[model samples]
Target: MASATVDSGGIGRASLFLASGTIVSRILGFVKLIVLAGMIGAYGDSADAFSIANQLPNTVYVIVAGGILTAVLVPQIVRASQHADGGTAYINKLLTLALLILTITTVVAVALAPLITGFIGLNLSSDQLALAIAFAYWCLPQMFFYGLYTLLGEVLNARKSFGPFTWVPVLNNVVAIAGLVVFAIMFGADPTGSRSAGEVTPAMVAVLAGSATLGVVAQALVLFYFWRRIGLRFRPDFHFRGVGLRATGRMAGWTFGMLLLTTGAGIAETQVATLATGQASVFVLATAWLIFMLPHSVITVSVATAYFTRMSEHAALAKFDLVKTDASSAIRGTTLLIVLASAVIAVCAYPFAAVFVSPFDQIVGIGNVILAFIVGLVPFCVLFVLQRTFYALGDTRTPFFFTLFQVVLILLGVLGCTQLPVEWIAVGIAGVITVSGVLQAALAAVLLRRRLGGLDGRRMLQSLVKYLTAAILPVLLGLSLVWLLGGTQQGGFAVSGRFGAIVSMIAVGLVMASSYFGMLLLMRSAELQAFLTPLRARLRR
Candidate 1:
């Protein structure tokens, strides 16, 4: 297939659109989290049950198709597009195959929802297990929708129509938030886990899990308009024997293996968290993960997605130098932003976490977890871009091997944490994630260097050091400011209300962020200037 035309403005503009969409989506997503936390406290049985059940579909989907759809689909679609029919036959057949798989998988999953829920919530009370099973009946069907959304979105991505894929999640979040609002109004706050399984009506289950699934369906279907605008029409093609699917199937073997390893680590982490008795359940760990992914989704993912297709095209054309350049720029840019973000988050971890959990104790619990997770933020972001580089080069096996190693490390780390107190279990999980990220990043860097002949390591490391150094003073100053403003070491701050907490976070955040950027400017950081150039140009206009 002919390569999709690269935007002349390069990754900057593409990243901007993706980043903007992600910013809005993340903001709304956080709002949804806050509402859900209010409706059901983060650590309670209901919260854990609902979280595990709701996430089960995603887990199953990833185990089955997520990695392939993400790591293998774009390049396959790009190759298929070179066909005489503009890849239409291949795409239709692939889509048909995906839909068939999703339908079958969803049905089987929904039927086994109770057993799945039981496994995920092994540590939950029988009532919690039953509630989770009920929720699963409504939520498990989301697997099909999730697959649909990914298929549509990746096709758009291959066509270089990126905005819809990034922005559609906003609709999902909005619908979910609306449902949460209604659930809160109807049931009031159920944060105490006081409601038994008998009290949760079928209508309640439909409202909660059904509404969530509705959001996924809407997110998937809304892409059809964009699909039409791109001049692509979907036609079901059942004759899949001769399309390029054989190659994709070959690639998917390794991709699926990689996901299995990653998912195994996730399950291990969840199980370990479940053993906890206090505020360290899987829900709490998941919330912290949400927070950890905020900067990543907005920055690392945006830049990586923007560059992936171009890089793939370059690799396809044997332009190894261009591929190297793109990978280097993305890594450096993502590292700088994520490092800064990690510093800011670490300093404000307490108040930031306080936004999601009410009551002082829960605040401290989630806050500590956030801090622990922050340690891995930079490594995780770096590894994200590097993995995409591998995907673009059509080398899924390397990542699989590296990830298998990382998962081994993660399992070891989590097992070692089994002796910690319940409240500290979340911290242990965070630690495991951080350790795995570091190891994964290191190994990915090594492999990427070999693949590219060399990856400008000296330059990248220099930037990393400078950024880390620049972040230190700002973080210390922010901590001091927070301390002076009645923030406790335990993650709570003196605030009149949520509004007060927001005010404090913004005020402190601005001052800290300014300090970080100011230092970067003073140090004459080239990457910082490159980052600011687009904004500067827009402002000059």
Candidate 2:
């Protein structure tokens, strides 16, 4: 049963499809990580150095063109196309501004990468430092290409054409992988090739690095073609030049401020990991992150696309009631999905972790220890979905403020926890991150309700109760089945002997998911209807 409140915007549908696309992208991204980790190994100082060295350049790209650009540009493009009356002209102005900013930023980033790397001194070996430097130079072109692609993607999204945007990463990964493959082939043929994979031969590293940058170029070109197909013209309009920069600058301030705070939180986590003995902290953090992002990729990113689209439409219509209803539905759907995903992760943590680190288990150890913190990832998933929903509503500042507060809490908690002599600082850091996320989500939810003129709190609570009932039964049954089948021990259950465990897990998951939907539908929960309708249609085939 749908809610009594009307939803004029197709938020529910958009979220579902968006999440599906995100899942595809995230899976490819995951595969990329696995391959990279296998190649780089896990525990060595060289790998550590590579991670740290790439961090700044990656940060520069994300802040200047990736996150900040996506967060700010999407809404503006939505407004300009949908409601600003100037329409195509407005979009052209936005694109021009984006180009100008990207050009300046890329030039600046390339110049700064070396000086910053030297100053930070991430304790890389001479070879590692050189590779890092090469990687930085290779990453520069991405700033320009990503900015263009992001603008085009945002335009497609605003026009409610998500199919093309969703597959853009497929193009990116294919190009990137091809480049890497070619670079490896070239390197392996070189006379100096036998000098260890980790040894950064300038020629080899430069080839790999340069190829990476070229991949981004390839990505942008594909997206540009799609943009043209969708009726976008690449006009370098200087019409709004002077004033446009100023407006963009103003928005950039807010965008960068939020990014800076979030980046600080990331840095804080890294620093804490650094304090731990060996790479245990990094391994755990990375493993937990991989698990955590699965749900986020599915739930949050999916919901964000729908939310952003609906909010843009609703803002145009001044349909506050519809806006509120759509927002509530997005939250409800995202929350329920996360709960389900958390249950799945909890059950499958060991197997999933094993697969992730299979090729490099020696370097990182068996990854099961990171499962301790996987539970804490539930709230983090919820927070990510909620934050994206808020941002989509053009209320980005609210999340910024809440994230700042959360970071404060994290800093204090981590600072205090480190003094306690825990062996796995990653676990302690996980606790802090979890706590911070929950706090932020709680605060944001309150603000969101206020913004929406109060959500159906009692109704939402009742739905949550039904969901909890549906979720718990399957989890318990699955756990019991796993325990009887030799538990989640790595060596105890051979894949041959443990077919029962796999079968039982599948059975339990299906049963639980079905039961959860049944309960929600029986309770007349709008969220259940929103989710199950599409699934039911697919199942009908």
Candidate 3:
């Protein structure tokens, strides 16, 4: 039997599920942005209004919505499922509490929207401000439903019912896209004809807001349907007097602490970025954020989903060896993924810039300059996966402390970068942050290893060498391709028109992916075999 491992069973299955969901969500999110960009156009008061209003609600979403969904609720569901609770009671109680919290938060948010926009969004015009308030109200209400949806998802994941969970985000994105199309029709045009009346007012920024609300409603309904199909039944239990209250309070307390730290660091980064001279430079920062977050979305969340489930499975079966092996595999897998991605990005970076940067030049001329810094962070970004490893071992404080330290380093780095030219500032910050990330990961690995007690260090190091060797070949090939293809000259891949950058990026991405795969095959790395075996099984299916 080769000693059945968590990697071979539920956790692996759940990870693939979450990964697939994330891919779907990311693709749809990309589409949604494209639609939004076309509808709003670039560089105007409307765009500014949408951006500011959206950020306000999103910040709340992250702090409140995401805090519970990822940290508190998911862990609780996993624990409940481990003891053969099958998730019903835990799901009901968590959802009930989440609804209560979300409703209260939404009310407070709506009332305070104007105040928030006034303080944080001081740059917007009157129309922009009105739109922001409307959008905030529309989207704010979703916090309640999504809180329940998140609970359902966590329960499904804990139950190893990942297929359902995976499809939910895709469904959510679909609704969002649909709403965008309708909003465009209703709003009439960017100048105001495209507005659909009740669909979303073009004159109001709430069109974007309405789309978000509709999407959440649709997503929540679908999740609820699936929850029912999965045999989950819930009754409201609002009394916070005993076990439920204690559990909810503890989870919320932990999650809020963690969320505050994370959100505070993000806010600091933005503040520092804003202090830079050029206005367009902020777009550069935003674009960098968009690009880096693609991988962060796919890798970090997928691994966390897997880690949490695997930990529960191991605890249930009393299979310590399997647990350790699965944990080690996860660490190695995520680390290699980060390394390979960084290498590829670093190698073909200039070509990618030529293919993707020019179009955004109108809003951001220093796009290519920022791309370098974005690539620089890839090395450190892998450490994000370390948080999953810690969480799996029932530790979260390590991540909190490590994150705080990194934030301090980032603040210092940004302050130092301001002394340099604007062009170098982004790069300098990226370099400092990346290096700090590496240090953080090293320290985390040390601490985690000591706490958990076993991690195939010797094999891990050997695998790293093999992985690096395999990665080097493609990087070399990619560099040659870029050099041969004009190497950052004015317009080798064509920079004009609506589809030029899109086509070029697609072509380059495909070539890079193919070449990287071929190189891995030639090396016959063990990691390649692991990926292939699972894929082969899926093919048989």
C-alpha root-mean-square deviation, each candidate:
2.4, 5.1, 4.9
Model 1 Cα lDDT, one tens digit per residue, 1-541: 1122346456887887888899999999999888888877787777777888889989999988888899988887777777898888888899999899989999999999888877767777787788889999999989999999999999899888889999999999999999988898887887655566667777788888888899999999998888888788999989989887888888889999999888878887877888874466787888889999999999999999989988877877788888898999999988888987898788777777678765677777888899999999999998988999899888898999999999999999999888987789889889888988898899999999999999988999999999999988988888888787666644335332466568777878898789989999999999999879878898999
Q: Which ten residues in a row have the lowest lDDT in candidate 2?
A: 1-10
Output the number of the lDDT-best candidate.
1
Worst 10 residues of 1 by lDDT: 1-10
What's the C-alpha lDDT at position 353 in model 2?
A: 50
* lDDT (Cα, tens digit) per residue for candidate 3, span 276-343: 42333333445455555666667655765667677655644566666667666766666556556666
TM-score of candidate 3 against the unseen true structure: 0.83
* Model 1 regions more than 4 Å off: 1-8, 196-198, 489-496
Whose lDDT is higher: candidate 2's or candidate 3's?
A: 2
Per-residue C-alpha lDDT of model 2 across residues 232-349, encoded as one tens digit per residue: 7778877885334455456667767877777767766666665552445554466567667777777776676657667656755677776666656655667777777777666755
Which candidate number maximizes TM-score?
Answer: 1
Reference-based TM-score of each model: 0.96, 0.83, 0.83
How many residue pairs clash in each candidate at the backbone level?
1, 1, 11
